[model samples]
Target: MRFEIIGNIINIETIAVGSSIREVERLRKTYGSGRWRKLKGTGTIQLDDGTICEAELHWYEAHGIGKKEIKIKFILSE
Candidate 1:
């Protein structure tokens, strides 16, 4: 859930954005009383020294694809 980004962003792409009218209205009071949207991004996480052997980074605004549901992706240098 917490980590340090030790490199500059080389390249990134937005994967998708999901929203539902019924779900948004149902949880409006909790998530906020407006149109609710979740985002997803993916890219290569590289070291500051410009190494090519980097890990694949996936970012999500909500929900999850890994251990924790974090909005930001942190890349640690080798």
Candidate 2:
């Protein structure tokens, strides 16, 4: 899965079929904070085949009073 984040918004593209909680945690730790802050909500993503997947938003917090960067990750259903 490829994770893309933009301004507190996250877009996830899963190319493989697999679910790992550890991966999610790694993603959260890698791109969860410092420069991004996770958005507390959900989004819908439309794939090339018109398949819609639920996207979760994560963001990085700015060091000071400035604009913050956003990152996104996708969650697969169990």
Clashes of each: 0, 13
lDDT of 1: 0.41
Q: Write the per-residue lDDT of candidate 1 for residues 43-69, one digit (tens) a residue.
A: 344344555433445543333322123
Worst 10 residues of 1 by lDDT: 61-70
- Estimate, for each residue in 16-72, the C-alpha lDDT of model 2 and write its tens digit: 221322243454465453332233444554555555566664433333423234334
TM for candidate 2 is: 0.28
Error of 2 at 53 (Å): 2.1
Best by TM-score: 1
Q: Give candidate 1's TM-score.
A: 0.33
Report the Cα lDDT for residue 31, model 1. Answer: 46
